[model samples]
Target: MKQDQKPSVVLITGGSSGIGKSIGTFLAAKGFTVYGTSRNPSKFENFEPFPLLQLDVADTYSIEAAVAIIEKQHGRLDILINNAGAGIMGAVEEVPNDEILKNFTTNYFGPIEVTKAVLPLMRKQKQGLIINITSIAGYMGLPYRGIYSASKAALEITTEAWRMELKPFNIEMTNVAPGDFATNIAAGRYHAPVRKGSPYATSYQNILSLIDNHVDDGNDPQEMAKAVYKIIQTKKPKIHYKVGQFMQKFSIVLKRILPDKVYERLLMNHYKIK
Candidate 1:
């Protein structure tokens, strides 16, 4: 494709529902050709109206197939949004090693594989944007969400490193750390186990109650879609973005500034698990 003839192409993973769907829909509305990748095409609401490509982030073969299909049609991808991840809710002790692997496979390694496949195309084109839908939990840990938090935290750190590494290649990496947005994350949350002799079983239930209440008042998905659009459109977007409740923004900052012990105690007291 010629320099001026190429159109903006957005390939989003986990685009069938929730935040990923919102981002894909918003991008589509902007006149960008959007391709949503999901494991189940049924999860894709309207492919006729838009476009959906079957993709499974946890599987390398699926990611390759999705990218191959996109490359065949578009030749070059301008935007890659790694939005495929789910929350695994369980105490670290209760959660089995296999479950931990499952969490990271989707949240961390899945994106890594997709990015690897697309990076070559972007490098050849000499321009592209990779947006990661990291969570506020990545910046600040939460009780009874240790696995989910760990996965997101890993993604966050890797995004930072990739940002620098990809900058020299003229590729951009943006990590959007959104505070709790109203989504199916809670409903779809994977509950595995509490480790042997774990004392967190009762405490986990308390955290679930808090989550149930907060999801009711979480930020609208549209707000996040708009934020995503802004990040993608900006010539030089911030490497890290935090959106949602002002209180969350403040708390994340506080954690950064305070001592480790201070933050740990604050979290403990905040959740009343002590």
Candidate 2:
């Protein structure tokens, strides 16, 4: 950020589209050397804002190769944004075990593996920042989005412990829990079918539509980009940062003060679950 200083090099997973793409583009505009990862870079031939490397977060070999490329080109990786994740929706009883595992693979384990790959570089540098992009849904379980909530909540809590561990290395770690943003996540989310005559059919179908509508009406991803930029400029970043609409953020505060059943009732009422 200083005139004589070298620009910071940044690596963002899941950067090919959605929130990741927005962050890369924003930081690139601000003079950060940015690289974004996609499972398949060849498919995004028109991607021009930043280079997209072929790296599937779920694959360790792919992650190592991508980090290697960044280290080769820049010689120092300064910031790692673990933004790669997927969404899953279903009734707890109806969603198959495999689907739940698949969601955790992408939304939970994927970020951890990516963080592990980048830590060596950051440790060597002796100064770095790792921002984990999580979700506000992580704070509380939404009726039909329990799996998605659990995956994000896992990352949210994991970052807290990791932040303390990384303190001695001067490598900062934080979680950014964002509320719904207008993106392709809804289309990509794995949804368990609402089978006819199944006990959860009507409720699940109704909640699914509500979930999609929330995403469709969500805020811009650029808001998240700005939040990330702010965190990067801070002298000492906190363990957690949240970006979203007022009520969405307030819900987290309410949960802290309200009784357990009261909070549960609030959520059930919001989702119209009897």
Best by TM-score: 2
- How high is the lDDT of residue 268 in model 2? 91
Per-residue lDDT value at 187 in model 1: 79
Most lDDT-accurate candidate? 2
**Per-residue lDDT of 61-114 in model 1, one digit per residue for the tens?**
888888888889979899999998987887776777888898899999999999
TM-scores for all candidates: the values are: 0.93, 0.98
| RMSD of candidates 1 onward, in order | 2.5, 1.3
C-alpha lDDT (0 to 100) for residue 146 of candidate 2: 93
Assess the local accuracy of residue 28 in candidate 1 as a C-alpha lDDT between 0 and 100: 85
In TM-score terms, candidate 2 sits at 0.98
Q: Show pairs that collide, candidate 2.
A: none
Could you give candidate 2's per-residue lDDT for residues 1-274 as a string of tens digits?
Answer: 1221888999999999999999999999999999999998999999999999999988999999999999999888999999998999889999999999999999999999998998998899788999999999999988988999999999999999989999999889999999999999987889999898999999899998898999999999999999999999987888888899999999999999999999999999998999
RMSD in angstroms between candidate 1 and the native structure over all alpha carbons:
2.5
Model 2: residue 112 alpha-carbon error in angstroms: 0.9
